[model samples]
Target: MAYVAAAAVLLGLLVVTNLILTVGVVRRLREHTAELAALRGGGSGGLDVDVAMPAGTPVGGFDATSVADLPVSLATLGERPLVGFFSPNCQPCKEKLPSFVEYAATRPQGRDAVLAVTIGTREETAALAELLGPVATVVVESDQGPVQRAFGVSGFPAFVLVEEGVVSASGFDLAPVVDRDAVALPAAG
Candidate 1:
């Protein structure tokens, strides 16, 4: 009977130890998840704080010149310019570019209104420029340059709607830009 009692106590201790270890692991997993979200620019949920500047914020200091030498500026644009930031190394950016190019091609205003800034070498950005150049102006820069900063780009594949020298909407995805001025953006700040 004493042996039986000892065995039961040992089993209980083992169970308790397992429970404690499980809890610790779960807590560590939660911390890691939060850290990843921070690294992914606030996760896939929405635009991160670093890039969620509200609409109507004045945007300036971006050079209007492009490789094409076509003058482009938020203040000087005649229509609502959809600006996209992309990087050659970003998978999502590469995947998202086709849709963005299509959207720019089909914009209702029917002018070359879209603008894309890609960070890469001349060769790396050439294909991207070719895709967007027909319907948009393409600007190549080293690193995230002043134009991207003016537009609040915290990560690759960021986009914003600039109307009259100010940001009207921004998002990690294109849904917000699609719904822009028509509905609420999930990541709008």
Candidate 2:
């Protein structure tokens, strides 16, 4: 009878400890959720993560050499240029490469209007630079390169439309920047 009584007490203590831990975990989760909500533009209910520099932000100055040995800088971006920041290791950047390439191919100013910055070494970025060369002026730079710092890039696969050295539109999605050139055509006869 005494053994049974001791076993019951131990079990009760274990259950109480478990409850306390569970409560602590739940409270921590709530606190985390609230913090995340605050970071999401103060409970605006928008889940869009702000990955890169926002629109209308002035692009900082940068001077870099492209894979083709061509000079590319803030001043040489022309009237408006589509700039894409990519990393060789980023999965999303690989996935988005095709779309960006296709978009660049259609640009009116040709390859000069597109700047593709790859954050990697020559050995690692060779294939990516090769692929992007046909469509864009490819620049291979190390992590936190001048081009990235100039554009204020915070994440990979960031697209920024720069007009007169100022960011016209910037985001992770290509649709917003691509849509700038989209014009509805008249119905065929």
Q: Which candidate leads the pack in lDDT?
A: 2
Give the worst 10-residue stretch by lDDT in candidate 2.
Answer: 180-189
The residue-by-residue lDDT of candidate 2 on 18-86, one tens digit each, is 999999999999987876655432232455555567887998888999888889897777768889988
Instruction: Give lDDT for model 1.
Output: 0.73
Model 2 spans > 4 angstroms off: 12-48, 183-189
Candidate 1, which segments miss by more than 4 Å at Cα? 1-52, 181-189
| TM-scores, one per candidate | 0.70, 0.77
The sequence of per-residue lDDT tens digits that candidate 1 reaches over residues 29-144 is 99878766654542454324545346778776566577788776675455477788888888777777888887777776544567788887779888887777787778888775
Per-candidate Cα RMSD to the true structure, in Å, reads 6.4, 5.5
For candidate 1, the per-residue lDDT at 5 reads 100
Candidate 2 Cα RMSD (Å) = 5.5
